[model samples]
Target: SFRRSNVSPRFLHSNSTSHTWPFGAIAMLIDNAYDPDVSAKQFWIDKTVVKDQDCLTFMDNGYGLDLRTMHKMLSFGFSDKTTVKGVQPIGIYGNGFKSGSMRLGKDAIVFSKSKSTSCVGMLSQTYLEKIGAEQIIVPIVCFDQTKSDKHILDLMQ
Candidate 1:
């Protein structure tokens, strides 16, 4: 029903290349964490600096993500909240997830869990450049009650 447009790899790379880290990206992430629809309550931001590693972590007690939400979150220029009738969304372009993670580092792993589902996905700029991938395939596994507990534990490990 919809026709796909031709987008060159160079264009994709250049378009995403940001010389400076944008604070809006961070704000977008926090805004999404607090969005009413997300049902997030407790939120946390953690930063650590060690000898070999310096990292930041953001966590929230949201409803977590389903497949569709995760896909839209990562897609360039795609956002469902922008069309909402009454509410105003903080982000319009849906660049928050991608751009924010990129600003943090070259690699990020997103993990989400709900009553019925739990999934893990990784984004790595180095990997993308090496593979010349136009799109990111976030491998997802739907788990049963027994596996869900174990899977979440393993992911944490």
Candidate 2:
């Protein structure tokens, strides 16, 4: 279910931490999609007809996360916005991506495409549990040509 990639980061979990909330995951999706560069576009939430799929999707025409930004998103306490001297962005603490995604499902599939490139990344709590790891591993892949088939999409770029 994950693409072959050389880059994967593991975030350690501690026994004393309680890191999930019922609404925080959904909130993260909305908050990240806010403030698009383009105007006259709206965000949406909908259910898909795919069988056995109970997940809800939040989508918008907002600027999507690039590979670099996506990597930072999965990392604990890593926010590029914090480095900007005069810029004040909301929730610069950077715990939202990991905690929120983990809370939402046993795994998360993040897909984002920029003008020249498209990327896919997956974070699986089940894999972490099976390995008895305190860390979360995110597998990422980037490509120029898009594949129509899901299985072929897992091939290395």
Candidate 3:
């Protein structure tokens, strides 16, 4: 037998409320990039217009997440961070991405490229609300970098 569990979209907003200030939410993302697993040497944040909507984009020169890792990151309460070379990871609870992204906007799309794989995932309150979704739904797509997939090329652009 199999069991199903659903998470409400409202939970995203509720979780984000833990951050008293917006800066705290942004700090969470920054800390994640600096964490041992990622060890990002550079991170960039920029404002851009996408599909007529203003958006903020974040990019990092870290070890990017694979498909499974990206899924876990978007889900609730799953963290695999470990201390490396005496540097302890700051995100231990695995709720930071949800709290931080939801605090900043109604939607977030993550595009990550590891050495062998590339993936895209979305956590979108706007999409959920628009579709009248009763439970949160995350869509993720993965691409093998070795293949010449048009989807991968499109994502890169």
Instruction: Give the number of the best model, judged by TM-score.
Output: 3
Pairs clashing in candidate 3?
A: none
Model 3's lDDT to the true fold?
Answer: 0.87
> What is candidate 3's lDDT per residue for 1-157, written digit by digit as tens?
7868778898889999999898898998999899999999999999999899989888899999887788898899899999999999999998999999999888999999877888899999998899888888888888889776624432311
Q: In terms of lDDT, which candidate is stronger, 1 or 2?
A: 1
Top candidate when judged by lDDT against the true structure: 3
lDDT of 2 by residue, 33-93 (tens): 5522212156787766446856666667756665676677665678655323443455566
Assess candidate 1 and give its TM-score to the true structure: 0.69
Q: For candidate 3, what's the RMSD?
A: 3.6
TM-scores for all candidates?
A: 0.69, 0.65, 0.89
The 0-to-1 C-alpha lDDT of every candidate, in the order given, reads 0.63, 0.58, 0.87
Ranking by lDDT: 3, 1, 2
- Over 4 Å off, model 2: 1-21, 35-41, 49-53, 82-88, 130-134, 145-157
Query: Which portions of model 3 miss their true places by more than 4 Å?
Result: 1-5, 149-157
